[model samples]
Target chain A: MPLFDEKVKTQLVQLLSKLTNPITLHFFSQEIECPTCQTTHQFVEEIASLSDKISLHTYDLVKDSDIAKAFNIDKIPAIVVSDSKNTLKGVRFFGIPAGYEINSFIGACLEVSGAKEPLPQPIIDRIKKIAKPIHIQVFVTLT
Target chain B: MEITFNLPGLETIEQRTIPLDSSVIYDVIIIGGGPAALTAAVYCMRKGVKTGLITLDVGGQVAETSVVENYMGYNHIEGISLVQRFKEQVEQFEIGFLQGYKAIQLQDGTIKKVTCEDGNTYMAKAVIITTGKRWRRLNVPGESELTGKGVAYCAICDAPLFKDKDVMVVGGGNSAVEAAIDLAKLATSVTVVQLLPHLTADKVLQDELSKFNNVTIVYQHQLKAIHGTNSVEAVTLFDSRSQKERTLNVQGIFIEIGLVPNTELVKDVVALNHNGEIIIDCNCRTSRPGIFAAGDVTSVPYKQIIIAAGEGAKAALSACEYVLLKK
Candidate 1:
């Protein structure tokens, strides 16, 4: 059975039609150790199929340890979205982006495809003025 | 685990909004992302003012709601989908937009300064506050410690993890009853511990919940503690009438008592009511001359989407008047 119904698929197609640049989805998972790995793998594949600009790359957590480390992924069922510049921009999902999180997943894809609005010049200057590297983690939920 | 997808119909847009800048002093800067803020942005933009918006999330509590039926146009709509529409509407204008950043402080002056959590300060001639409410916590023992371990505030996200296990829901409002209904479908048994003698949720929700035989409603009961080491093991409930306490063994507990207004940043700046809601007059003007407030965060008689949107429009016009007069 397909994960997305026809109605949802049509909407997905319409939304993905707006993608301007290519986005790469790098999914890392273990074959057996990760409980939600299999489901999450299917989700990533299905999401990538929605847009021609989106491409998917599957990797085993154990086999691609170095790549996983570079992405700062320490857990299974993780997905990193690479931007148009072919660089990861901290767009990482730790688990299956199902339920309400699907909205975020779809939004991230569009953002990675250069569909995002730019930040202000002052905010950009503040970012450039940062002395040390900073890692920001976000948890998404309704409440 | 059961995976229920809340996939919304995707919306595509062009030239949505401009980036919010700190260098330019805005005419009006709204500090929220829910219905009120979104409506205010549209009104301000249409009124031909250089407007801006700052928020951590665009939807706020409205996004957390499962379904909404009260907002005029549609009989019923998914809360998130409605939020998406509101967002698209706001994006059509050239309003300065900022997301994933919260306004931490309000420095009241001729040119009010809105300090963000990112250590950046934004200035505006007039400000409209629409920061909505947040989920109220039980503040019981083990709740803060075992937030993700087992005690949860989001029932839709965490309900799947408690499959076939016992769980308890606190409160008697719409959110609590809705959480109980969701849990009863998956959990072995569902118990609702409401402080009131009767469930205060809408009649429809209460009726829907009653259809489930596995669910039990304990009226006038208060949660004392959530006992667990690593995960939730049990919870203590206190009965007001009996003046007794008892422990209910459960694997999970959902706290949905109610919501508290997000007025902490403006508590000292604005005149707040006893409940901490920002006090606003008929024009949505706060005690501060140039600062205005709307939505559930204000001392509005009723907290409804329609009400918030109307108040937001009024606030935008009032702020626009302020900016024009100041100039």
Candidate 2:
């Protein structure tokens, strides 16, 4: 059975039609030890099939340690979205991205494809003055 | 409680994007994602002012509600669904959204600066504060310790976790009564302990609650303490008139007394009323120049979603005028 119904798939297709650039979903999971890893892998695969602009690359966290370290993935069931040129846009989802977080995940994909910086000009100018590294981590729940 | 992944409306696969360019300075920064803030964003965008919204999440308090019957246009709509529609409308405009970020502090100056909890500081010419409010706690013994274990704040979020269990709601207001009615459908029984002689909720809500046979209302009783070992097992209530205390055994307790405005970020920057809500004029202008407030966080007469959205429009127009004057 399909995860998404036909109605939802049609809507998704229409939404994905707006994508200007190709996008890649890099999913990191372990075959064993992780419970939601397989489900996350399948979900991304199903979503990737909806748009020709979107593709999925699955990797084993234990076996492909080098690739996982390159992506700075510390946990299983992780997804990283990149642009057409395989350039990382700093979009990362730690968990399955199920529930209400699916909106966030799809939004990030669109953002990467559009490559439009939404920040206003003044904010960009102010951010340039920051001499030191400023790390920003936002905590969010699935609900 | 069973974790169901296929819950309807849980997975929203809508496609939307918020672009963030650190180099841009927004004309106005709205520090919330509720109805008021989203309305402000839409108005600001239409007025050709660059707007940015920083919030921990979209939907705010409305999303936490189960049903919204009072909001105009919709006879009855799920709170989350209403918020989703609001989000969709706002997405048509080009507004920057700093999603999943909480505003920790605010600095009022020529250019207002909002410091987020994630260490990012955003600058805006004008600021509209619509941070809204959160549920107020009982502050009694064991209430804080048993928060997630048994003491829940949102009935919509935790009601499913308490199937066939007995729960107690503490408040005399509409939210408490509504929560009792909502919980009564899922729980075996719901006991509402109000601190007043009569319910302060609207007559319509009172009437609806009266129809529920599983709900028990205790008037003129104050919550003394919550007693439990691992989770909430019972709550002691003191009858104000009789000068006697009684304990009722319940597995879960929902605190819906009222709400506390999220004005701590702007408390030092703007003038606040006795209730800690931001003091704003009819135009939604705050005491400080280049700053505005609307919605429940402000000294608004009503806290309804419609009123908040109207106040938000007013604040956005005022903010646009402020920006023009500065230029």
Q: What is the TM-score of chain A alone in each candidate?
A: 0.82, 0.86
Residue-wise C-alpha lDDT for candidate 1, range B57-85, written one tens digit per residue? 88887787678899999899988889988
In candidate 2, what are the lDDT values of residues A46-88, reduced to their tens digit? 8899999998888888899998888888888899999867688
Best by DockQ: 1
Position A116, candidate 2: lDDT: 61
How would the docking of model 2 be graded? incorrect
Task: State chain A's TM-score for model 1.
Answer: 0.82
Residue ranges of candidate 1 with Cα displaced over 4 Å: A1-143, B1-11, B202-208
| Cα lDDT, all candidates | 0.89, 0.85
- Weakest 10 consecutive residues, lDDT, candidate 1 chain B? B7-16
Per-residue lDDT of model 2, residues B1-327, tens digit only? 111233223234443436544567889999999999999988998899888888888998999877899998999998998998888878776688777667898988999888886677888999999999998987999999999999998987888878899999999898888788889899999999988888999999999999989999998999899999999999899999989999899999999988999988988888999999999999899999999998999998878999999999999999999999999
Which ten residues in a row are the worst by lDDT in model 2 chain A? A115-124
